[model samples]
Target: MNSGDLPPSRPLLVVDDDRKLCGLIRDYLAPRGWQVDMRHTGPEGLEAASTGDYEAVLLDVMMPGMDGFEVLRELRKTSTIPVLMLTAMGEEADRIVGLELGADDYLPKTFSSRELLARLRAVTRRSVRSGEAADAGKEWSAGDLTLNEETHLVTLDGGNLELTALEFAILASLLKAKGRVKSREALLEEVSDRRFDVFDRSIDVHVSQLRRKLGDDPKQPRFIHTIRGVGYKLKEPA
Candidate 1:
């Protein structure tokens, strides 16, 4: 498959201990214009994910040696590579745990091929959009948080901050609409290319992660503020 025809900048990486599933994914995505590389064990997956130029990673929660959580936790320390975790069906806790560990999205183990494709496209498209030059030279700032669209660089208190694509997009949305309460629906629409229900808590999870990285306390807030049941807003420090 010619990778240039795909939305992702590079090949997709699928990491699962289940060889049959990995093969199935490769078979499904390849004909659809995505090149896929599979790594079976957690350690191997972590190494490939850390070293490869893949557009995104399809990870399984249950794995050998390190497990997906351990791998994702390690990966997020240095790289913001998009990760779509595969979890058992109806495992809400697994989904939340994966999200908290910085997984961009989660798919059930029994997902349809079409949903899989849509999800893969959605996550990869975010990376492509985030890396675009459309916002070149523009900048947004609130308190110590500064984001340079041209450089795709974010800084807090003069220190560089590495943010996942989703986190960066969410932060940018909030920064763009400074002092206004951005409801989850409005925020999700602005940041995601895929359709997400207004009640999806993934947006809230990303915001929490972003807030932690920004060193803002949810209580006695410094930058991002929860506007009661409305949504969130970034207050310019006084």
Candidate 2:
């Protein structure tokens, strides 16, 4: 199929060791205008993702052999295909790890399929956006920080920050709204290209990762500043 014919209503791969769940997802998603492919093993899932022409990948964190993190890391070495992870372990640490490893989103195992579908749409929408340009202000610069909305690229202090799209978006949003304390929900809504909800800790993880990449110390940040109990602001250098 043509590239234009593939996304928004294209095939999505579901990788889980639980065959029954995979079957259920395939059935549930098929009617919603998605072509679903199911796999019960990590290696197979990775292989399928690497070779097949799927628009997005839904990966389960705990598989018998390779595991989702391993597969995601391996896939990152080459492909930039969007990946959303499923985890039975709902620990914040696990979700942070997945995000750090380049996974787009993480869904806890008990999450509803309806929620999964919403997340899937959101993730795919983000992937599609990486190929396009943000409106009007497609480029933003402050001090030594620069962001290209068209290319989804960010550079800080004369060095290129190898940020994920979300990370770049988060930074861009902060820079765009410089001097304003943007709440976690506001940042999530701005950067994630979707609605903000209760589980907004993902924005925090992305910000933390961005801080590390930019060498901004939480205790003595030179760029992003945290408000006591509110949110974050971009510190424009003098």
Candidate 3:
């Protein structure tokens, strides 16, 4: 097919030991204009991800030598590239661990190619939107929490809070809304271009992580308040 017939090529890195699965992903995504680079080992994947100019990274939770969590931890030390983790089906703990370690999103190994494509697009879109917003050089503050959009840095009570890309997005949305309660659907829409699924608890997980970093108690949160049955809102400092 001619270049005009295909969308602009998006570079993606897949880090997984399953060569067969990587090959399948490459075959499925290549025709759709994604340049898929496969790394069959955690070290190789980490090296490529650190040095390569990839729009996104697909990581598997299980790997030999270095594991996905270790690779993710090392990568987060330098880069903020969007990452979509691949976890075994029914492994809720693996999903939570990936999210806690800064993964942009996660999908089960049994996910359809269509769902994979949709999630990849959603995460990359979110990253681009975040970059654009950051370029605006905006600063937001409520109470002791401060967020610098340009730097994508957040500070609570004069101390920096290390947040993943998704966590930062969630916090930014809540900060923007301030005292207004933001429904889970609204929050998800702001951070991802995908349709909302009531069953998805990814948002909740990220929010809980953010609260922990902010030292906000879930029951009596000083910065974020759960409206229960409604959603969450950033509390105005009294």
Model 1's alpha-carbon lDDT is 0.86
Give the per-residue lDDT digits (tens) of candidate 2, residues 1-238.
3342323368899999898898988877777778988888889998999999987899988898899999999887777787888877557677878888888788888889778877877777776676678563478887888888777777877777676656666787788888989988788776665566666567777788788888889998888999977799997876
- Candidate 1 Cα outliers beyond 4 Å, as residue runs: 1-9, 194-199
Q: Is candidate 1 or candidate 3 better by TM-score?
A: 1
In the range 1-238, model 1's lDDT, one tens digit per residue, is 4463454335889999999999999887887777899999999999999999988999999997789999999999889989999999988888889999999989999999988887887787778777886578899998778998778889999999988988988888889989999987787767765566754687788889888999888997888999887889988987
Best by TM-score: 1
Clashes of 1: 0
Sliding window of 10 residues with minimal summed lDDT for model 3: 1-10
Model 2 C-alpha lDDT versus the unseen true structure: 0.80
Give the TM-scores of the predictions, in the order they appear. Answer: 0.93, 0.84, 0.87
Instruction: For each candidate in the order shown, give its overall lDDT on alpha carbons.
Output: 0.86, 0.80, 0.87
